[model samples]
Target chain A: GESVGLHLPTLSVQEGDNSIINCAYSNSASDYFIWYKQESGKGPQFIIDIRSNMDKRQGQRVTVLLNKTVKHLSLQIAATQPGDSAVYFCAETGGGATNKLIFGTGTLLAVQP
Target chain B: GAGVSQSPRYKVAKRGQDVALRCDPISGHVSLFWYQQALGQGPEFLTYFQNEAQLDKSGLPSDRFFAERPEGSVSTLKIQRTQQEDSAVYLCASSLAGAWRTEAFFGQGTRLTVV
Candidate 1:
């Protein structure tokens, strides 16, 4: 399960298990959202994204679910592997004044063997 | 270039010193962005440039921070009167389109430490 808050959260799971990461955005008008995975000493790599028009989108081994009523987003990894270990971030864009992604604190996903 | 590239992977500056971080985005990227990531935090938007025009700089934290992209291919982020609070990893990203329309590629980032 995933918890939503301002502080960074940690999700530890077995290599073959499933992992879920969560984020709560502040703006209600946000129209787009993205999930990024960042390895240590490296830049963020895009994993998946969901627009306001859709409540759920599926990618290879990953799924993003958006709950507009709660203004919440979640990323689920299927059969998580050690290679998936990294800090996962959820970013949002209201397409308003800034037109920039407003990123959440991030969640550290650790897959233990 | 094959991907986004940043210079001087690591930097340490005195509290009052000024520093410049550079970003070489992917070829033909129309949108370039600068972000600041503090320890254990996700990247925060600083500024954005569409080609040579700086369309958005509203994310810059203060007057001490400035960014420029004169020719549209490369960009620079400058910080003046750096303080301890200024220490963070500066990340640069670029996309094929403007705003939130596309996925952005990111550079490794420059770790700036103000001592």
Candidate 2:
């Protein structure tokens, strides 16, 4: 079965530090990659997405870097804040027949102030 | 109206009971999706509907989980004979089919607890 997996289950960082979460996907056919943030008792919110053609995409405070050769994806958060603490998930789309996304086992990011 | 909306923000059902979850997508949206999220895990794909036509439902866990998007608008996810493992949050998302990319807008989600 095709699946996406995260390198770390949890990451703890200081409020002002930079945070980097990594994901490894098994499907190379996945053309679309997305990063989502989920707070407690809330649904996953779309943060940033990158197509296979692009190796890097930047949002307001986050950046998604894709490495197709290694099937690795990463989300980088700059100047992490307390409000940025949440479970971050990396999902891949366009791999399967259906336009559904394959999500990874989220990485919980704890920003300690 | 603004984004995807799900009813019965929380649900508590006894084992073997049947439950129905509702989702109201944004007006004029053409794609709707349902996902199940377990504790400490990301949302798992469940089913998808494109303008009332069920394009795919391969991600449904079992036959007991049924979803319908009648009239190509409001959708429902029904779980029959629910088990303890069925306890999770059901999320509904919608996207514009005409768009080039599939960027889903998710609802708050319905938390189902099977005891």
Task: Quote fnat for model 1.
Answer: 0.65
Alpha-carbon TM-score of each model against the true structure: 0.94, 0.93
CAPRI-wise, candidate 2 is acceptable
| Chain A only TM-scores, each candidate in turn | 0.91, 0.90
TM-score of chain B of 2: 0.96
Tens-place lDDT per residue, model 2, B1-115, is 6989999999999999999999999999898999998877778999999899988898899999999998999999999999999999999999887324677889999999999
Backbone clash tally for model 1?
0
Candidate 1 Cα outliers beyond 4 Å, as residue runs: A1-7, A97-99
- Separate DockQ for every predicted complex: 0.57, 0.46
lDDT of 1 at A11: 84
